[model samples]
Every structure is written in C-alpha cells, then in structure tokens.
Target: MKDDRCEGVIKDAWVEQHWGNPINRLVTKVEACYTKLKTWNRTSFGHIRSLLEKKRKLLAQAEALLMTRRNHEQLRTLKGEVYELMVKEDAMWHQRLRVEWLKAGDLNTSYFHSRATQRNRRNFISKLNGEDGQVVEDEQKIGEMMASYFSELFTTAAPSDLDPILQGIERKVTPQMIQELTREYTAKEVEVALKQMKSISAPGPDEGLHALIKQAAAIGTISGVSLCREGPKVTHLFFMDDSLLFCKANSHECNSVLELLEKYERASGQRINQDKTQLFFSSNTNQQVRNSIKGRLGVAVSHQFDKYLRLPSFVDRGKKQSFSYIRERIW
Candidate 1:
C-alpha cells in the first residue's frame, strides 16, 4: 500500500479497483475453505474431503434458496456474487497456469489449465541438440555445452582485413544527410523526456523509492546521448538501452553501419558492449563469409536466435512461421 521510496505510493486497493482484479471474490472463496478446514476437529484426508463436499452442498443450497425466493434485491446480490466468483476463478486459473500474454476472460480457465500442464512439461529439458550433432540428455553435459558454446562466442577472434569490402561500396550519405544526423541533444528536450518517463513508468515501478536517484542519473546520461540512423531510407529501432541496426549484408554496408555506431559512441560518451553483441547470418551465408563478418565487427555469429519483442527472429521466418507466436495468445 505504501512505499519507502516515495510517500503515499500505489496501494493494493487502488490496483484491485483500477486493474479490475477480483481480489475480494477470490478471498471469499479461499478464506472460507481455509477457515473451515482449519477449525475441523478431524485432520485426516478423508475428513478433509468430506468437509469440502459439505461446503459445496451448503453453497448449492444457498443458491437454490435465493432462486426460489425471487426477491429482487436478493436475486441481484446473488447474481453479482456469482459473476464475481466467476471472474475470481478465471483469474486464479490464469495465474496458476502462468498464461503470459492472455488476460483472464470468458471460458479460458480450461484452456489455461491445459497450457499450465504443457508449460511444466516443456520446461523440463530431457534432451538437447549439441553443436557436434550429438544428442545430450544429461543435465551436466547440457550445462557444459552452453558454457563452452558461449565462451567461444564472446571471445575475440583474430583480426582480418576489412579493406576489400570497404572499397567495394559507394557512399550514400552526403553532406545534407550528415548535417541532419549531427543534430545534438538539448537539456530542455532531455528534461521533457525524463518528466514524461516519470509520469508513465514511476508508479509501482520495478524498484521503488531507492531507485529514483539512480534512475535520474542513468536517464540523464541516456538523455545526453543521441544517435540517428544512417539515411532517411533506413529503419533503426531502439528499445530500453538496446539498439538494432539493419542494413544490406554486404561488407561495405556493414562497415558504414559500424562506422556510424562508432561515431555515435564517441559523440555521446557511450560505448557498445562488443562482447555481448551478436551478428546473425542468413541461411545462404557460408562459414567463410560469416567468419569475415564477425572478424570485422568483433561480434559473435549465431545461427539460431530467439524472441525479440515477444516475436521470434528465426533464421527462416516464413509467412506462416512469422505468426507462430501469435497462436500462443489465441487461447
């Protein structure tokens, strides 16, 4: 309800009201059962089962009585209670089942129940495909495989000549483009961005009051930095502290893109963590080509990739494949 970070912070009552979560209904159901079970003189499983049956019969009788009486106020109260119970049940099943992308709604409890089971099953990695074309089922061996794979991935490679590819391309960025890209960050603009972020993301944030000072300093540094994409025709995406650069696979294009990144780092007093950077190769790119690309950028090459923006960036993303993650939310 209250936070040490900021005075009079977000409270559970407000969240339950605004978020439309059926907290009261859930408590009503579970608390009654918990209390009844606790107070019972017997402690055996058989007695517990009988107690549960008794509770259900009592609820059923109460419902039947309210229906037969047909008092308008009673009917309305009972109807509202039943709806709340339904909502609470839906929310419970959804939470327990761990449905990531779907909200609790009509008739999804049964589906969520099954997905929870599937999630549990899928989490257990009984086997893994090793890079050496060997099946590794042992947990220790899987750990070893991952550690070794990533070690080689982040390690710096021997330098190779990038001059050949750099010579092959013509410059697309001219003086006008350079002038536009050279736009600097102003303190006023930085303050506006910080204020906007505070309003939207400050309440019930990841880390509470203690993080305010840290966030201000970090965000201030971030605000002082600015980087625009190479050309108006190019598409560049930025999220959080991450940046993604898209360009032609050719070496000239790659070199140009890298150069722009380097310039941005120097200008903004920020640097990219090359050890964590990765370069994904197309299916058609041979080992020799991939190696050359990695050498130039000092980035690791990855044949397989995972989700970004909750969507998979697979090597062979076909029309059907592109929408596969969407199917997960359909339930």
Candidate 2:
C-alpha cells in the first residue's frame, strides 16, 4: 500500500474513461484499481515466502564468507536486506491472520505462519453430516448440504407480537430512550464509531440461553453432575458459544436436554455444529448407558479430553503432576 508504483497504478486506473450508472461507475473504478494492484503485486512484490527464503540463503552465505574473510560491509548489506524481507514476511502473515495488536517491530513470521496454518486446519470441514444421517465427503455435496442447512436455518418467518411475553419484564428503556435510539446519526458519529471498533472482536455473551438452561435445571427437568460431595452441582458451563452441559446418565434427562436444545435453536435461528460437538462421560458411566445416551444425542463420544480453554479438563489429586505442562511452556 505504501509503494509508489501502487499509487501510480491506482491513479491510472481511476482516470480511465468509463460510462455507467453511479453505482456501476464506482464499481468499475474499484474493479479496475483492484486488477491493476493485483498485477502490480504479482510483478513487483512477488511471493513473500520465496523472496524471504532467498534473502535468508544469501544472508547465510554472506555469514559463511565473513567467517573465512572479514567482509564487514558485505555482511551488513545482506543482514539489512534479510531484516527488511523478514519484516515484510511478518506483515504478510499478520494480515493473513488478521492480528491487529501486533506492532511493526514484532517480526514473529514463523509463529504467525504456524498460527495461520493451525487456524486453517481447525476451520476446514473435510466432511459433513447430512440431514438423512449420512456422512457427506464430496466437496460439492458438502457445499450443497451447508447451503441447504443455512437456507432453512435463516429463513425468516412472519413477525409476531412480543407484548405478552415481555409484559412481565421490567422496562429498562423509556419512550424517550427509544426515540434517542431510533434517531438519525450524523456522519461524525459514524466515523467515530467505526474508528473506535476493533478489526475483530468476540461476540457478546448470550445471557438468555444461560437463563433458560438454569430454569430447566431449577425445575429438575435436567439433572447436573456433582463433582464432589459438597461442591455445587454444575448444570452447564459456557465460554463464548461453546457449551458443556453436565447431566446424569439417564434417558429422561437426555430427552429434556434435547427439547431444550430444540427450543433454543428455534428461538435463536442458530443450529449447533454437530461436527465440533462431542460428549464426554465419567469413568463410572457404563458402556451400555454411554451408548444409549450417545445414540439419543447423535453426537460422538470422546474418551479423552486434553484441555479446554487452555487448561486441563480433568485434574488429578496431585496438583503439581496435573499442572506440569505449565512449567514446560516456553518462557
């Protein structure tokens, strides 16, 4: 973006004659500028990885020559060139990972590369379960399945009145407040709001879902697992959108949990991603009961849990032994 050639290309593309409607005219300019930039990037910038590798190899050769003969000036030039390419490589990975917090001097190119690769691996869906309880592996079939699933999931329905449901809830916002919320905003306000927002941020927590599950647990509709003799019964644990629901190994509670999930899906217009969902049971839970609950939930059973939220999921009596990985971490 800071390249002089890039600026020239953009200026040239913008000056090109094009006649169209206002929107089309704007799009044409943008498309032309994008094409020019793409070509410029290919020709001038080239591949950052390949360029960085070449620079590193040259640097290594320079260092080897320096060891045999003291050519300080040549070694310094190669070092500077390698450093510049390293910065460029780091910047490329930072943009790919969308990490906004990293500063210019933090040249963690390899770390960023590994993190981006890990993210790609974690997000890629090689297979998907269709509605008919069959696994879909074909790329086209998976795409079609996702499209169909999301289409039905997001299809809007007729608006419904909320007065009856919201009547008992205390009003936090007054009519005047509503007017303030609905009022038009000036350009300055929009600019300030946009500037204040982060490049990426986590979504707000859903307290309503927590309330609904808590209500179910309160009414004994769903049982929770008790960790110790006197510890509080943990019905459910939530972090962002991922949830861990604890319930007894029984058919009745399983059905109730499924009903609650269905209600949540209907209300929120969001369905659970079965690909990432899994069930873990205590050692005392027999194979027969595990199989029954697994069939009912239609989620895979996990026999081992390494970590959740960067901490060990299951800890032993010896705290030091359970937390040895903490000491093993790089400083």
Pick by TM-score: which candidate is best? 2
Error of 2 at 314 (Å): 1.9
- RMSD per prediction, one decimal? 15.9, 8.2
Please provide, for model 2 over 179-295, each residue's C-alpha lDDT reduced to its tens digit, 9 standing for 90 to 100. 999999999998688667764553353434565677777789877977889888899988766888888888999998887776566555567677778888888889999999999
The estimated TM-scores of all candidates read 0.34, 0.55
Residue-pair clash count for candidate 2: 0
lDDT of each: 0.54, 0.77
Kindly report which residue stretches of model 2 are placed more than 4 angstroms away from their true locations once superposed: 1-93, 105-177, 200-207, 225-232, 329-331
What's the number of clashes in each of the models?
A: 1, 0
lDDT of 2 at 273: 70
Tens-digit per-residue lDDT, 9-72, candidate 1: 2222223322235786666545555454444322323243344445556556666787567566
Q: Name the weakest run of 10 consecutive residues (lDDT summed) in model 1.
A: 1-10
Model 2, poorest ten-residue lDDT window?
A: 159-168
